[model samples]
Every structure is written in C-alpha cells, then in structure tokens.
Target: MPPIPTPLTLTQLLNPPSRDGLLTQIVSMLSGLGFSATDWETDSDGRIILQVEAQTLADLWQAVYKIAQGGYLDTATGDWLTLLAQSQYQLTRNPPTQTIGEFRLTAAGGVGPYTFNKGDLVVTYFDPTQNNKALIYRSTNAAPVVVNPGTTRSIQVTADSPGSAYNIAPGSVLVLNTPRPGLTVDNQGTLQPAVATGAILNGPFFTAGQTLIVTSALNGGAAVGPTTFTFTADYPDMTSVANALNVLIAASPQAGRITANVLNGALSLSTILITGATAVDQITIANTGTANISVGFDTGSATSVSGAYSWISEYGQDNESDTSLITRCINKWATIGTGTKAAFISWATSADPDVQKVAVYSNLFNGTPKAGAVTLYIAGIGAFDIVSGPVHANNVYAYIFPKLPIMTELFVAPAARNTKDVVFTAKIKTQYNNDTTKNAVFNAVQNLFFRLTIGETLYKDQVIAAIITIPGIVDATLSAPGIVSDIVPAINELITLGSVTPNWLVVV
Candidate 1:
C-alpha cells in the first residue's frame, strides 16, 4: 500500500494563466525587445494577429492544465474521476434506482376483479412543503385483480422518481393524488401485516385435534380465539404465512362467507367463515392415515401495513456524486485485507443510497466487549425514523456477509433514535406570515437534526443558532432544554427531531 498523498485544491495544484494575462506578458516581452506594445492593441488588425495568436497559445496552455488535472485524484472530476475510480480502485458510480413497494388498492364499491395494470399509477396527495409536488407510484404487477367485489388487491408499484421526502411516516401518505371511483389506496410504513380477518375451511375437515383458532383482534363482533397455535417464524408474522395457513385450514368450523370488517386484500383462511361442512375430529385421505393439523391465525388489525411508504426494501440511490465516488475510491483501497473497519463501512455504504450514517461497534454489544463480534448500527432515509429497519438490516447483513474474515460474527440493526422536540419562542418579522415563519423555524431545526450522524452531540446553542439564522426570525430563545447544554447520544443512537413548537411573537 502506498502512502496517501497530500490534498491540494485545483487552483493550488495548477495556476493556469488567463488569456489577457498571457497576452500582456507576451506584449511586455516584445516591448522589452524594442517592438512597439501599441502594435498588439485590440483595435488594430496587427493587434488581432499578435493578440489572437497570444490568446490561442494561452488557451492551449489552459487545455493542457485541465488535461494534466485529470491525471490526479483530488482535482479530477466527471469522466476523469470516473476512470480514476474504475481503473485504480475497481469501483463505479451507482446509478439512480426508484423506490418500489407492494401497495394495496381496495374498491369502495365495484363490480368484480378490477385489474391494476403494470403501468397503473397510485400517487400521494400533493404536499404544500414540496411546492405541491406529489409522489407517483406506478403499478408493477402485470395484472393485480380484485376478484371479489369490494375486495382489496396488492399491487407492486415503483415510485416515478426516487424521492424519500414525504412518504416515510406511518399514515403520512394517506391521501391519494387522484381519486379512482370505487377504489382507495393505503401506503403505510414498516408494517406488521394486513388483516386477513375472517377464515374458513373449503374442503374436508382436518383429522382429530386439528383446530382453527382466531387470535387476532375482534372487529365488528368477531371474537378472539384460543391461543392454541404458535407462530412459525418470528419475523414474517401471520400475514406472510396467511396463504399457506389458509390452505391448511380445511376443517375449521368457519369455512367461507367471511364478510365483516374486511381489508378486502389477501385471502386469509381463518377469515373465511363459511358454514356448510360438518366438523370432523378425524378425517382420512385415500391412502393416508388420520391427519393431525392445528392451524391458528390472527385476524389482527394493522397499524403499519405493506405500502409504498415503508422505504423498507431497497434504498434506491441517485448516481453517485463526484465527491462521493472519489472518497469511496480512496476508502476502497483500505479494504484489501477484508476485516478492517473500512471494509465494513465501504460494504454497507455501497448497500444503498439512503445509507448516510453507519456506526461500527467492533467486538462490542450493549457496551460490553465480545471478541470476534461486530455490531453495525445504521441510520438512513426511512419512513417514521432515520434508523434502518429489519428488512434493510437483513439486506445489509447479506451484503457484508461474503466480505467478512474467517470466524467473524456480524449483527446489523437500525440505529436507535434519540428523539428530541425543539421548544422555543421566536419573534417573527412583521412582514413575514406567522405561520410561514413558524414552519421555517421548524424546518431549520429538523433539517439540522437530519444531517447529524450516529453518536454525534447536538449543541443547544447550535439549535438556537440554526433557528435564528432564518430570515423571518427576528430573535429566538431556547427554553425546553432548560440547562442549556449539548445532548450527546450513545454511539448506536441518532438524534431525531420529534416535534417543533415555536411560539411566535410578531415584531415590527
């Protein structure tokens, strides 16, 4: 490994003389040799010949300067920087990718089996903050049909562009851009799962001891059933296994005709409440012995559902900036041995574009040291919080898995949030609208917190400094953080703006 070179600005590395300066020097040299300086004047034809020739020579030198700059690391940009990153360190800029998620569209009152074609769009309501710009999500499913009237169907949609500004918080994306008659959309964040309310058995009953229990919330007089069955996996929850669990419930008393509080989305067998088949304790197949199956599902309600707002999956990134590519190229060289701190960060940073701040805790968990263990606390652009979610953590872990050294254990989690509300009173300039000034102050504080990294300390004065810098704010004072000091977070924690309450006082 070669030693890193000293950093130098473009102007410092090369001083390309201006054409006028070069021309003046050329005239000065000619005049010193007894030639008339007036001959090179801009107004005369003789001047055009000598001056233009001098300018041409200067232009060639400037071109040479820029071409020479392309050979260096810090001063290079555009294609020059791209080649440096590629050739010297096997790296390339990440192209922009759109955010995509599976969203559910429910009909208000429809005929049957409505198709949301692959290119169909579901858009968020217009936002006042973003100059009334709305996020548009185009359906990716070839044919997402709602078979039954008034049923909800899941359609995968991709954002028109990768903008993570408004669709991150739960219920933040409730409004639709345009109304589709008899159809409504729900775009949620970090969801548990959609409710598969009523369940029923379709075929012959299960063998003896096979019971279908409903443990989900009882909406519209639906009762919570016995807690007889345990969940198969802890992460996926009941909804993911709903399809499989619904198929295995062939003996439940509730078989078909489930029609109460329906999300009208996916089919949950437990939500099926048909009443035709006789309850059998034991049933045998043609060549099989008595079957035993105990299937139970939660008709539980949803808070955060699978939506376009989750930002849970891929963090679609725009093309890498020149500054970022150069830094990554330099960092790439540090990852040669593959177990260094740089290796982990380089891998995680490359995972997605939203990945802004990543804190690496080597040989430590909960502040306790454990040999051969690495815990990565990551925070990125996400709905509801800056911290990365389980899905993202899993994806990051998978990306870093192949790069780990022998016998190294790795754990990845979203950075814990240290939320703080900013409470202050600001004297607003009389000309500025009180509401507008208040909103600006709030945004100023929030934007500051958003830019902070994991384990960074937030100075109370810095917060006050940020608010006062707003053009509308005449004067401001911080009160809630009564002591007036810096708020330091744990290494694995990120400071997030919870709420901003600015008491505005108008001043002439």
Candidate 2:
C-alpha cells in the first residue's frame, strides 16, 4: 500500500512549540532566576511578565512563517497575493468597465440636421429588484449628431458607471434625460409615416422661377425637379403654388403616386408610393432654381419609438474576484512562452472586460491537430453570435495579434451559443405553495446553468440535487432534454439560458 502524505502549513512545518508550553517554560525559568509573580502584573489569562516574553517569541516564529508563505502562490493571502501577481506576471486586478450602447434620436416633422450633443443623459427605468435604482448612460462625443436629409439619428452612450448591472436589454433604456424635447430613445417603430412624406412648408409663392425639388425612394431615389410651365401663374397663394408643384411632380414619370396639398399657408408633400417598403422619400424644395427665395423643408416630428434601440457594444464587467484573479495569475506562469495554450487563454480573457469565457483549440477546421494553429472561442457578457456577433471578436483579434508567437496561425472567434430548454416536473411539499416553490425550482435550474463555464456539461444528477434540495421541492425529475443523464456542448459552444417550462401544478 502507498503512504498518504500529510498536509503541512509553514507554521506547522516549522515544528514551533505551543504558546502555552513556551509560557510555562518562561515562568519556570524566571522562578528559578529568583523573579516573583508580584514583580509583573497578571493579565486576564492568569499569566505575568512570562506571558509577554512568551508571546513575543511566538509572534517572531509566526512572522517567519508568513514571510515564507508569501513566497508561494498556494498559501499567500490578501495584499501579499496581489503583490505576487504583480511582481511575477505584471498582472493587476481587472477593473470593472462601463457598457457602451447606441442610443438613437428621432423628431417628427422637424428641420434639417438636429444635433444631440456629447454629455446628453439617458437612463433606464427604476427596477424594483435593485431597490428602485435607475442606471444612467451618457452620450459620448463620438455619437452621431447629424439629422440632415432625414429625421432620425443615432448616438453612442456610455454607462455613467462601470458594472455589469448596466448591461440591460434592448429598448430598456428609453428615457433620454438630456432634456431634448420630442427626441426619444427606442420607440421610432411606432410613427408609421408613409413613403416620400414631407412636413407642410408654410409659404406664399415667392417669385417667377420658384420650384420644388423632390427625391424619391425608388430606383435609388433619383431627384425630380424644376417645373417647365407657368413660371409666375401660382405666385401670391400657397395653395396655388402647391397645386402647381403637384403638376410638375405628376409630369415626371418618377413621382408616380406622390401628392401635394396646402392648408393655412402650409404645403404638405406626401406619396403613397408602394406599400410595405416603409419609405425614405424627401420633399425638399430646392433653392437652386432662378427664384431668389429661402427654402425650409419640415419633416414631421418623430420620437425615437421606432428608430431607437440599444445593444451593448462593450459589455460592462464586475470587478474580478479573488478566485478569478488567482487563477489568472497562475495561468500567467504558463504565459512566459507567449505561445502556449495557457498564454492564449490568459491574453484572450484580458482582451476585454466583457469576455467572460474563452475556449482554446488547435486546428478546429481540420480533424487532425495542426502545429501552431490555434483558434480561440470566446463569449461576451450577453448575446454574442459568431457569424454576426458584436465587437468582441474584433477586440480580441486586435489585442491578441501583436502578442502572438511568430509564425503561429491564430484565429479568434465568438463562441457559438447552445441554447437549451429547461423543463421539469416536481413533487412539492403541501405546506409551500406550488407557484412560489415552482418559481424557486426554476431559479435553481437557472443558477446551475448560469454558473456553467463555456463547453461545460450539464449533468442530470446536478439538476436533481439542485431541485430536490430546495426548501419546498420534495423531489424533481428532468424532462424534454432528450436524455436523463447529461447534456454536453461542443468545445466551441456556450450554453445559453432558454425558455423554462415547469409543470409543478400536478400533484405527483
């Protein structure tokens, strides 16, 4: 039989005598040296001057033990652990990063080129689960500001603070708190305006050569322009001018279904062009003609209801935990080569705060392993697809390219998601209501899936334990997963949470 090795801490390995034994020895030696207990005051532990002497010696031994422990990865604690990571691998704790989202702005029937400036504020609704706290996001200077030739514009916003809590769903942040009236966040889909629609232009005919310029949404939107008839006939009346412009538009084969009308000196230009296309037609009266008059085209007011939706570009991350930091620091040991698999994993994770999981493989395209060929499969905080995923792939490639080993073929890709349905039937204790207990069971299932790493297996036993251990669930059986043992994913796949179907109402 082989012998089992005993565990040893630095303090234990030193074989230092007990504090009590040391105290007793000190007291005995002092007594022999003719010192009396009355000479030194006694503490609550019933020791005299001997106690202080014994404790000081014990502390010295512990100091030596801690110093030795600090030099090793397995035994170091707190700030000492941080120092080892810093000095050895140049690694610091990962800081939390803020999420960047694209917030769009729209105004119905408005003027040209509206600007939503940098530092504009947008916020999420107060969530009850977060103690009624609302997250704020601000527009960066890089956000687009021009609304020229169109009434809708999109802008970029950064979360006010760094944290995963700000990685909210699309359309969740609709409050543009920057005080821009009539400009909205993510409701542009509701406006439902027709094709080639233009806001009414308030005007009486200005001059002999005044003309309206029309741009179509057909055949790549060729412009239809300057009427050939009755140069001054429509002058001095807005309705006459609109009717005249309508004639010119009708004369052009391009403006097939376009219409123009005037009411109270406002000329409205619109087209019922083709249904189902959701048009982008423009009715700007061009000032390029011989008429010396100013022109203002008003597209109707539009809220962002239809035009605005935000998705996380760079997902925010929570501060790294001690365990994750320690694991990374250990991986740094393998990164000294800059070409090892560990190096790839370490650098890929460090590429972005949102990169939560990374899977590394050699020559995934070929069945046989090819030397120096590596592909990294990584996932962001939420909703990253490989073929059409966000910038996580770009961010990773940019970061890892320069750091790669010479002549090594490296490919970085977002991990493909493997979504699965969570279904279960459970027996519940009568004292606990089925609805509340069923919800708890689903939460347990979600938690299990949530904690799973990329490419990890989902075991049936784990599911059983999770549900059965719940306070109200007496037992549970898995269903609809096609197997009762375990669900496994490909090496390049990540398990994403899907729909949950819990049939907990049945008594059995």
Candidate 3:
C-alpha cells in the first residue's frame, strides 16, 4: 500500500528548522503561482503572521492584496488555508446543527396570506399533550407581514443566548407541527371550540307506564341515574309527556354534567359545556318501558371541539456558527466524491442537526433503469420536508451522487414521515411501595422509546439496561421478545417504539 499522505499545512511547512528554511519551502510552493511568502512572525495574541509578495499588475491582484491586508488571507490562500484548517478541526468540533426544514401551510376556516412575524414560534414532538416543551423554534424572517400562500418559511431558532449550545435532529415531525404566535389576523388561531351534540327521538314518545334509563360515560363523563318516567294522569297527547320528561331530566342532579331538551316534539339530550381539561363522551339510553322509543342524533349534531392551523410553506435556516462552518468545510474536503453506504449515511446525518436517521440502499428498488440506482431513506424526529428549496432532492443528490464512482446513479427517496413500531415487553421489580413508583417505571420505558431515532437500533439488552438505570426498577427481564437481539432494520425503514408494555410489581 502507498504511504499515507500527510496534509500540507502552514504549521508543518513552517517547521522551525530555522525561519529561513521554512520561508524557502513556502516560496517554492508559490513560485510559479506569482506569490511568495516573504516574512513571518507570531503576534502577542498568538496568531501567526505571514507577509506575502504578490504580482499586483491586475485589478484582481489589487483587490486581493487589499483584502489580505485586513488580516484575511487572499482568496487562493484562504481556500488553501481552509482546506488545511478542516483537516485538524475534525477532532475538536463536529457538533450537529438544526436544519431549515420545509413544511406546508393551508387555511382551514379562513382567508389567505396568513402572516407571521419574526420570532414566531413553532414546535415538533413525540407527544402532543406537552405544549411549548418539545423541539421549539422561531421564524427568522420578519418582513412584508402578508407572506404568500404556500409553505411557511421557517428556521430552527432557539431561545438560547450566546455561549450556549442547542441541538435538534432532522426528520423531526414537521407536518402538523404547531406554529406559535398563531395567526391573529381574521381571528385565526391554533385552537377551536368544542361542539355539543343534539339528537332527536325518531320513534314514538313515552307512553303511560313506560320507563327510560340514561347513563353518561363519554369523554371522562360521569354516571347519570337510570331515572324512570311515568304518566301521572291520563294523557291524550304524549308530546307534553315528552316535554315533561325533558324538564325532569334537565333539572336532575346531573344538570351541569348533562342536559336534556324537547325539540320538534322529540326528546333532545346534549352534553353540557365543560372546562378545557374535561370532555363529554356518548351517553347510553335504555328503554325498560313497554313502548319502543328510538333515539339518534338530531339535525344539528354536537361534535367534540378541536383546533386547526395552517401548514408550513417554504423554509429558512439559522445562521451557522464559525465552528460548525469550519467542521462542515473539513467534512466536505474529507468526503468529497466518496460515495458508499456508510459514507453517504455519515454525510446525510451530518448534513443538518435535524436529520436523525438515514438509510441508503443501492439497486434495492428499480424503476426506469435496471441497475445503479441508489435511494437514500431519511427520517427526522417529529417531521420535516426533504425536497424543497435549498435542501431538496437535488442538493441531497449532489452530496451522495458525485461521491460515487462514475456509472453509478443515485436518487433520494421520497420523504416518508411515517414511523414503524419497535415494540417491547418488560417485567420490572420496584423497591418503593408508593403509587408513583409504578408510574415512574412506565415513564422510564416510554422515555427510552422517545429517545430512539429513525434508524437507531433497539437492543433488548439496552432496554433492560435502561430499566435497571431507573431508581425503582431493581430487576427487569425482557418478557415479550424473550431472545435477546437487536432490532436491526433496513436503511429505508423508520421505526420507533410507540409504547412499552410492562408487567411490574412492587417488592417489599
């Protein structure tokens, strides 16, 4: 094998064999290029200084020389220095950066140009109930207030100030991600009011000696008494009896819990308005009476209230820090034209902070061409758009395709937001006897799944290891998939443990 090639760096080129000796080597490298290193020094700040002799006959030379005097290297020199700097930056840096993910935006019950201001927040998560606590970001652009109608352009922004670091992975759920500082124009927000149901009795009204039983158990509902209704005196018309029964049920102890009314000579029951934390479920009505009375939803039905908002369109990016840029520059140099499964995966995961998992399969699925086609399967945390604007399919192709040898074709697979289940069953023994202990164990199991990425492996041992780390879980065993093995999926498959089912008991 050929000897490993050492990088040509200023530090190495200026080796202290004597200042004259180093200057001679630099001059030799620049001799034919019309540039020469004349003098060098180390500043009090520890920055190395090098004075270069350049041919300044043209306007380009004049411009470059002036810029170089401002402490920045000339374009040619800067490019070379960047290449050298990247070689060493790998070991020191390489932290992930948040990507400018793309998403769609549409008006559900409103008009056009749903505008948002700078610092408008948006979020993605594995769970929806936890609000403003997921991967939160803000809009960087704030102009023309009335933006266009399409995908909302947004960048991953943090509330973090300088000197601190924050990171988020790609393939994070971008679709349906809640946009903060919601659209205030035209009263468009992220939430909508809940509606109640009103149903009519299609069958005949209550007859004499007939009884009706009502039970409420819908949407965290309470139990309504199975009240019996009977006619006091002989009645020619039963409509008044239905009205009387409606009044009776309406005035019952379950008034705020539920309500009943008579509409169009039919008994109408509706769920009363509850607080945001509470909701109403379907009520059960049984007829123990002799007459048959049919019941169903009325003309205007009550629906559980919900909120809707616009999708994200376009995309934006946060400003990359100097360290990140330098790391990227180095990666570009090291992996240029290097296309392989491993190389591509590394390149993609490093492409942006948001990209959590990646799978690349060559000639796996064929279409037009018989062979030489490679597809990259990428997934993020919550959601993200793969093809749009700068970070689209073509950009991905450039990163992987060029790296592959000639005659091999590369294609970026269509972005898939769906997640596959990585199920597991565990039995745990806890030391504590408190009610919260069991909950804590379950939470620990779920947390393991939440931390899993798209292409990450779900090892049985790792699961048990995680359980043992918890305070209450003294001993745990894998019960479901008894054999210990890794959940290794293909490159294109994005899998997640939706939930963990555990059979646990407290120990004395």
Candidate 4:
C-alpha cells in the first residue's frame, strides 16, 4: 500500500507536559475516534484519570486500541492502566456476562456431570465441610469457591457423614421423594414399623392384646394387631373385636351395626316403632355368628322396664305398647222428641228407655151438646117461648210461650297470676234465642290476630276469637235487627273474658 503511518511519541502527543499529561493525550485521541470522556477523577499523587463512554463495548474497545496506538500508551505510567487494557480487550472478544442469566448442574443416576459455558452468571451454594472438605479443581489451579466464569469441567465432591449425608454428590439437591407406609398397632398400643423401604416410623409404645385403636391422620382407621417382638407376629386382624368396634364407631349410623352384650351370653334389645300412628312393641337382634341368645318377656325384669315404660307414657308416649281399656261409659237419653233430650242428659244412666212409647202423638179435640129435657118441653108449644134460652158465646185463646234469653260469657285467665296487659283478638258466637233451636252465630272472622298475653291468656284469646258464622239465625225476621246485635255483645263479652285492656289492644 503506501508508506506506513508514523507512530507519534508520548512527548509530542502531550505537548504541555504535566503529571496528568497522558490523560489529556488519551482523551484527545479517543475524542478524535468519536468517544466521549466523563466522570474523571485522579488520586492525590498526580496520575491520568479518565472514563470514556461509547455506544457499545465493542466500540469502546476499538476506541481504546486506537488511542493506545496513537502515542497515548507511551504516556501511561501506572500498572492499573495495563490491567484495565488487558481486561477491556478480553471483554470485547467474549460475549457479555449479563447475557447469561443463570446456570444449573443437573445430575441423575443415569446422567453424569457436565458444565456451563464461559461468561455464565450462575447461582450456587455449597458447603465444603459437608462434602469431605474437597477443594474445587479446574484445569491446573486449585480454586476456592469463586463466582467468576472460566473454563468448564465436571465438579466432584464427597460426603463427610457416611450415614446421614453419604453418597451426596456435588450439585445434588435433597428431595423428600416418597411418603411413609401404614403402621401396625398392637393390642398393647404399640406401633410397628412401616413396611415401605424408605419409610420412617415414629410412635408411642403400646400393650399386647390390649386393643390398639390406631387412628391415622391420612386414612380414618383404628388398626389392631398383636404386640409381638418380631414384625411377622404383628399381623393386623382388621375384623377383630377391637377393630370392629373402632369401625362401628367410625361408620355412620346408616352404615354400621351396633350390638350390646356382645361377649356375654344374655342380651336384650328394646326398640321403638319406627313408623305408624299407633304404639307398638318389638325387638331386633343380629347374631353375627358369634353368640347364641334367648329373647322373651321377663316379668322379673319389669323394674328395669319400668323407667322406660314410664318415659314412654310421658314424653315417650309414641313408643309405648298399646293396651286395652277396662271399661267405657255410654250416656243414655229418652230421645223423646227430635232427640233433644239426649243433649240435656248426663252421662250416668240406670236403664235404657223404650223407643216406641215416646215416638209421636196427635192433639186432642172435643165438642159440646145441648140439654135434652129442655128440648123436649119446648118442641111443640113453647117454640115461641123456648127460643129465649140463655145464649152461649164461643171463643178461642192461643197462649204463646216466649223463649228465655241465655247469656254466656267466656273468661280467660293467664296461667300465671303475675302476667298482665296481654293483648289479643278473638271470635265469639251467641245463642240469640234460649230455645236452642239454631246454631250459634258469629261475625268478622280473621285468621291472624295480634297478642300481648302470656300463657293461658295467650291460648284462650286465640281460641275464643275464632268466630263461627252460621248461614241462618234462628227465628230471624227480616223486620228484626241484623245478626250483628248478637255478635257485637258476644265479642264484648269475650274481650272482657280475655282481660285485654284498651291500651294493650295492639290490633284486631
């Protein structure tokens, strides 16, 4: 090409020579190559201080190299500049450390060791004390644990503890791989070791044949087995008495069977009827192939049954055995006319009456006759004179019996004497005529009524207030007053009966 460009000397590049003369020369050369210098600082002992910024690391490296060749290197006096120059050159040749985010060492039974590439920023923690105090070796150097990147090689390590940490290789992670197997419980409440090879058994001691109720946190169960020194003798009888009892307790009423006196020869079961309106008596038993039994009514055991029978008669009446009544009373009445006598009769009666005698009867009638002697004497001659006999006047009078008025008042008292100011609404019926010829008439019937009363007052108001409205009132004439006259008075009576004051009347 042409003659090579002459290299400028340090003295010539830094014309105004001083302690920081190389910094000026380096900055001038870098600026000429399109680099900017910033954040410049120098030590007390005068030395060139400079920092240059470029678009990229590559651009920065190129600018550095160019400045070094342009007589700036001759001006550099310290070892730091040399090191910095070497480091800069190495960075330009390799990819950035930030590009490699993380690295992991994967080791399996089949897969051996491998390594990550250079410039990797990896996260790893290792304790050499745990791994036989083995030092990490790379290439030819014995290295302490370092975070920087370099050449790749397999990492080797050994465990210090043979039992706890043995066979633990470097880069190996600990994982809880499997769960513990089920444990066997003995009658003595001792837990046997888990069957799984890698399982760990932790327990409290138990007694032999004393019934081991094993309750598992994972599966709900009471495991029962014999307490033996050997594992073979710890066979679990899942269907044993203790086990069955546990199962029965765990199972729901729908699924389980309950037996009383399981071991004893004698057993009795008392059951209440599950359905039907009438009371019934019955017993049920399940043999379970373990016991024989006899069941009968034991009169001697009546005392044991007494409490239950009394309970049945009281609150437990629904469970009682139905019995026949000794005697029943039937009231008798003459049934004289329209069977009204029966309503007036008391329940007690000595004898029954004949039905036909009082069935029906007609009203009697009579006629008057004239005297015969006077008629014979006046027949011929005295026809003129006999006509003067006394004249008789005929008249008929009808006597109507008026019905007496029957007045009835209902009274409601609170069950407790102290209860007061109870408010309630009620319905009442009235018998307008004492003849008892018609049904009681009522008015203004409503379903819901307010109450401020307590106990019996609460009940009485609710009952009497239930109005009965009949379609017809006995002997009710169109010209007479409406049926309300009777209803209003009855309601007033009921209100007084309920002892509900005006202030307490919440609403009707």
Maximum-TM-score candidate: 1
Output the number of the lDDT-best candidate. 2
Model 4 lDDT on a 0 to 1 scale: 0.20
Residues 360-400 of candidate 3 have per-residue lDDT tens digits of 66663211222675556554432233223124333455555
Candidate 1, 382: how far from true, in Å?
Answer: 5.6
Candidate with better TM-score, 1 vs 4:
1
Better candidate by lDDT, 1 or 2: 2
Off by over 4 Å in 4: 1-127, 130-162, 167-239, 242-246, 249-508
Q: Per-residue lDDT tens digits of candidate 4, residues 397-446?
A: 00000111133111111011111112222221243321111111111111
Q: Score each candidate by Cα lDDT.
A: 0.53, 0.56, 0.40, 0.20
Each model's TM-score, in the order given? Answer: 0.56, 0.51, 0.34, 0.10
The clash count of every prediction, one per candidate, is 22, 19, 31, 9
Question: Stretches of candidate 1 above 4 Å error?
Answer: 1-13, 28-41, 95-319, 365-368, 381-388, 434-436, 475-487
- Model 2 alpha-carbon drift over 4 Å, by segment: 1-22, 31-46, 52-65, 96-319, 365-371, 380-389, 434-440, 479-486, 506-508
TM-score of 2: 0.51
Q: How big is the positional error of residue 437 in model 3, measured in Å on the Cα after superposition?
A: 7.7
Q: Is candidate 2 or candidate 3 better by TM-score?
A: 2
Alpha-carbon shift of residue 333 in model 1 (angstroms): 2.1
